[model samples]
Target chain A: MAPSDERHRARMARKQEVVAAKVARASRDKGLLLVLTGIGKGKSSSAFGMIARALGHGMKVGVVQFIKGAFSTGEEAFFRRFPEEVDYRVMGEGFTWVTQDRQRDRQAAEAAWETARAMLQNPELGLVVLDELNIVLKHGYLPLERVLADLSRRTAGQHVVVTGRGARPELIELADTVSEVANVKHAFAQGIRAQKGIEF
Target chain B: MAPSDERHRARMARKQEVVAAKVARASRDKGLLLVLTGIGKGKSSSAFGMIARALGHGMKVGVVQFIKGAFSTGEEAFFRRFPEEVDYRVMGEGFTWVTQDRQRDRQAAEAAWETARAMLQNPELGLVVLDELNIVLKHGYLPLERVLADLSRRTAGQHVVVTGRGARPELIELADTVSEVANVKHAFAQGIRAQKGIEF
Candidate 1:
């Protein structure tokens, strides 16, 4: 096609996209499951977005923080404002090394899993954010089969997200979608420190 | 508490977390919007496990998923990956019924404020997952304030995840972590039936 023709096609395509967006917006479907794996960061950050997003819409939200425990971060503080808006929980007992207790970690995992299981069973729950659970299974902290079964049996409309490094092939296989983060580079390696709000 | 009591408590805590799987993973601190927004099914699933937990390990993660994107479906996907993870964007699209105009859904506010801008400005974007962005800001179709500015100013250390109903956000987001999927939800939802692997 001539350049003018190509330009016209592009313009038309743009218009069509605009219309499509409108249609999609008007035709929203049920929520989804997102699995974040690989060697990159931002998995939890993305999940938090969903948690906040769900609450913003006046939808009930529940968060299970597997590794961070119940410590208050900027996000937890923000989420706290809407105590009624979101049913959130910090599952982990701080950092693994800080705790320096294997048994404690296992207990934390089990406790968190219990909450996760309960939330999963609730039919009305719209979105469930399971942060850093891959490691829980990878380390055998939680029964993989049980987690898989629960996830498979979750409410039809509920959306679930699972994040962590070394995501098991079984989990990936079972997951509706899988993402592997391949690390290209990092700033900490260059002797840079983390900043607040941005890195907290 | 007394130091001796604290010591005893710490020891007990350590014993509890024992046997909990612990793996050392590396993450990056880039300052760009690493979006995973598309018309795919697993944006949040992928974001939660990897990004959030990474943040928990002293890494920073930011997330933003458009539409009534919040809610806890009872999955440990994102927050489990915290510390290394923080920052979030929930589109608050709330279901399609509220966001009647795909082209001008409520995220128009998000798009206008440029929540992505603040996230992009951070130099420690170990991961920036723009969960569900494609549907939210396709062609700047919605309010085009912040999303545009952030997309334009994003640096390299940040990662973004965007997931949800559509794919236009992908055009400008320029995802380093891009994966688009056509979901196959439960067959029963489609009326025929609900299978385990293909549908779940």
Candidate 2:
């Protein structure tokens, strides 16, 4: 039957009622712990997008990059345009594969974690983005327990977003929202270079 | 074993060589057809992030929103700040559940697609974001064949991003890159409201 049919209209009416009830019941307000993971793109990009959203809503934001930063990215240049609203830091020496020294990678991650911990404790920062921190935790550069403790100790209304592949199960368990970005297809696999303004 | 060990050093050397060769092979550059879908948050958020990136790289962007115009979103507000750099449109009556009118939705989606088609043909637009287009396609609000035809007819150097849940198989096949954002846990499930700046 067409959507204009009585049966379809009736079904939709019933569905709407149920949905409205559910929406009405969701009344609580609290800080969100979000994990963006899986071996695909958009993990960090989404977090940065949230930073833009928070800023639009008059929220101060902080960012600490843990395992990127070999080269400057488009986000760094753009967000830097709003220095007063965005506290952006690119602390990673580079990826572990590029650094090739566990000790150096550990030092970079530890320093990045110090900044992240401080941001987590800050109530004034409406949102804190720990970009690529998952890779640091996966490589054991920082203690997962310590990271989790710091996340838990955050101010009640300060949102936190952690992004990268290979998210820890413990972190996922504690997160209020978890999104796994699955790589269905990739341009790189098709011999297309990761171009500027798209991949970054 | 420590990364400074001979074996680890040798392994890193071999891996780096292979990665460098792969990077060298990816010499071709072309327009990208990206699909961001699946039932989770950040699909539109990531697309907005790419919009930011394109703007940062001095690229003019066009955005056509198909099914999300009931309320004002943070992305729309932020991007509006850069009106000269962005062409943003919101052409939806609302979600199907909210509007409860099929004829109106079809008219709105068709109108939105007309704008999207023009953007695809315009080579000057470096990036075009079809926000929530997948949902429109899924709902059969617009003709699938016409949509695909317009996509394939896009300018050689223009990038296009389509975001929403339940991507069509034909669209996915045409997409150079496809990401499925899986919802593992959502705060709404725990009675937490989808707050402003984060969920919008």
Candidate 3:
């Protein structure tokens, strides 16, 4: 082999050792608390993907949509197809700005939380997705401390994914993994109405 | 009614009119090019979510996976269940860093691109997810100009979602919607192994 090729192989071998060591270090197995948040799209979509992944493994999942339920969504329709595997619920009336009724919104949020809390408690549910729960918390419709406490109370090996914009810092602190989907550009801004399958 | 309640209603009514005007202005109906990129998780997962959404709407979709085919994935397993709606293809042998074979990787990318091109030409496929195509472009495995040209050739009502880290600037410029999944924290970094449903 050429000198450059030989050098490259050696470098890769060294790097492989490092990665292997890191992989070995991560020996523990525990269900994770994941938070997908930011002022961009895909947070809830990613959670829905995880729902599919969980269902792929024959794992039971529960979905609680806390806000933005004014219209039906593609995910809701898709996941609901598997009633046995996916326990899907659309609990929000709409965004707080749209609802314009703090009492009604709070009641909706509390009802959604009750459902999420029940799912969290059930060890049989391998994954629980709280879609847009962060928005409910952000609007002060639900108590953050209580929500965090319930998340902590989930049984071992029960993964939870919380999604929405403006995730609380406390929730971030308690999460095992956190991702922020940052908006670079949006189609709606360009005079394109939200499509059925793609957006809703 | 209370004075505060009356004032709030008036404010909401005024803001609703403003939003209504903007909604009225958005009259265009065209297929969009969506790009999901950044050094974070969920780019491919979001693409899979879109696949599910499209399938729910009875829309045909094609998926071309690049740079990550060393092991089987949950998405491949799940989406394969719907053979009628999803044309799933895993073309990449592995990442370039792991494969360490540029010629082989280039061939794999070329093959994947060929599959993608076929999907793009068929307007019957409502959404074509070019999973990890960005990585191929970033690594110069495929020509960006050729890829962009093919994307532009897709029928007026056909949508495409390109997902991977390190998206080309030109691709972003061409895309109607763009999002960057920013990594805040990863569980693997804390010595936790990647779990099946959540990571795979």
Candidate 4:
């Protein structure tokens, strides 16, 4: 082998030792509360990807949409095909700006939370995705304390993914994994309308 | 209706007019180049979700994984099930740290790019995903200029999603949409091992 190959091998061997040690040290196994939030897109999309991952492992999943029931999404259409594996519910009336009724929106959020609470309590569900829950929380439709309390009651091995823009500080504090999708540039800003199969 | 309801209706009417004008003015329809990057999770996962969306529309997709060919991913398993609609290729030997051979890694990246180039030229494919391509570019395994030139040659109306950390500045500039997944918190930091359904 060349001298460069030898040097590369040595460097990798040292890195592997570190990585292996870290992997070995990480032994805890429990359910995680994951938060996907920010101004950028792909929050709910990421949560839906987790749904697919859970389904791949033959684990049941539950999805509750908090503020996107105005129109159908490709994810909802696809996941709904597997009724046995996915307990999907689109409980929101629409976007707050579109609905424009705070009282009605709050009622819708409460109804969605009720379903989410039941899913959180269920041990059989490997993952529960609260799609756009942050928007409702941001609008003050639901009390943060109540939401966090319900989340805390989840089974030990049941994961939850909350997604949307403007996630509360309290939710972030309780989450094991939190990813904020930052928008660098959007197509809409470029005068491109939302397209089917791409955005819905 | 209650007085609050009347006020809500008036507010909605005004908002609708503004939204409608914005929607009406946005009419551009063309293929988009989307980049998902940052030192955070869900970059590849979001791309997979888009694959699902494309499949839902009965559109063909092509996927070339540049640096994650060693382990089996849930996305690979799920997307492979639809061989008729997806042309999926895992071209890399493994992660750079694991492979530890610059020459071999470069060869793999070049081979993957060859496949990706063909897919990009195919107008029938509505979407193409270059998973972990950012890593290959970051390492200079493949010439950035060559990759960009090939991308520019893609057929019109064929969307592409390039995902991984450390996306190049040039790629971001060329992209129609770009999202940076910010790492607010990670389960690995808490000594939590990557679980089958959650991480993989």
Supply candidate 3's per-residue lDDT for A92. 91
The per-candidate count of clashes, in order, stands at 112, 0, 0, 0
Candidate 2, pairs of clashing residues: none
lDDT of 4 by residue, A162-193 (tens): 99999999999999999999999989888998
Q: Where is model 2 more than 4 Å wrong at Cα? A: A1-5, B1-7
Alpha-carbon runs more than 4 Å astray in model 1 = A1-31, A69-71, B1-200
What ordering of candidates by TM-score runs from best to worst? 2, 3, 4, 1
**Candidate ordering by DockQ (highest first):** 2, 4, 3, 1
lDDT of 2 by residue, A53-131 (tens): 8888888999998867545688888888998988989999886667777778888988999999888888889999999
How far off is residue A79 in model 2, in Å?
0.5
- Ranking the candidates on lDDT from highest down gives 2, 4, 3, 1
In the order shown, the candidates' DockQ scores are 0.09, 0.69, 0.60, 0.61
Candidate 4 global CA lDDT score: 0.86
Off by over 4 Å in 3: A1-15, B1-15
Q: Quick one: best TM-score, which candidate?
A: 2
Poorest 10 consecutive residues of model 2 chain B by lDDT?
B2-11
Ranking 2 against 4 by TM-score, winner? 2
lDDT of model number 2: 0.87
lDDT of candidate model 1 versus the reference: 0.57
